[model samples]
Target: MLHVNARGMKCPWPALRAARAMREADAILIEADDPIAPSELEALAQQQGWDFAALDACRFSLRRAA
Candidate 1:
């Protein structure tokens, strides 16, 4: 598991960092206060067929599909 802090990051930055971490992780949990985090990550997960769950308004978790 990997945790990414994107509280102050802008769009693309959080997504980009998360993507980088995804390369090395089987699963990742991303925490971002940004409003765009969920949408952006949702699209990415959908495109990749990754499993994702929104923990709350500002936190989400992604798991690699088996």
Candidate 2:
């Protein structure tokens, strides 16, 4: 699993980082403290057909569609 630490970053930044990682990784764990990160990341996963899970309020895991 790839790990992306986007803490202290805002909305699109966190999601963008995750998306970039998805291109090369099968699974990614992103940590973003922004209040909107969860929803934004979830939307990205939904659109891309990846599995989305909230490991916690500030952490998310995304897996590539199989």
Candidate 3:
């Protein structure tokens, strides 16, 4: 799995990076503390048809829908 550390990144950036990374990997783990990252990521996953899982308050994972 690709690990994306967006802990300090702001909104859109974390989601952007995760979207970009998705092209190269089937699964990705993201650590984003931005207040809006969760919503953005969830939207992205929905739009892309990926499985979204919130590992914790600041950690999330995305996997290809199967």
What are the lDDT figures for the candidates, one per model? 0.85, 0.96, 0.96
Worst 10 residues of 3 by lDDT: 57-66
Steric overlap count per candidate: 0, 0, 0
**Per-residue lDDT value at 64 in model 1:** 83
Please give, for residues 1-66, the per-residue lDDT of candidate 2 as tens digits: 999999999889999999999999999999999999999999999999999999999989999878
Q: Rank the candidates by TM-score, best first.
A: 3, 2, 1
Question: Candidate 3: which stretches are off by over 4 Å?
Answer: none
lDDT of 3 by residue, 1-66 (tens): 999999999999999999999999999999999989999999999999999999999999999998
Residue lDDT tens for model 1, 1-66: 899888898887777877888899988889887788899988888888889889998788888889
Arranged by lDDT with the best first, the candidates are: 3, 2, 1
Shift of residue 49 alpha carbon in model 1, Å: 1.4
RMSD of 3: 0.5
Query: Which of the two candidates, 1 or 3, achieves a greater TM-score against the reference?
Result: 3
Which segments of candidate 2 are over 4 A away from where they belong?
none
Query: Higher-TM-score candidate among 1 and 2?
Result: 2
In order of appearance, the predictions have TM-scores of 0.91, 0.96, 0.97
Task: Estimate the lDDT of model 1.
Answer: 0.85
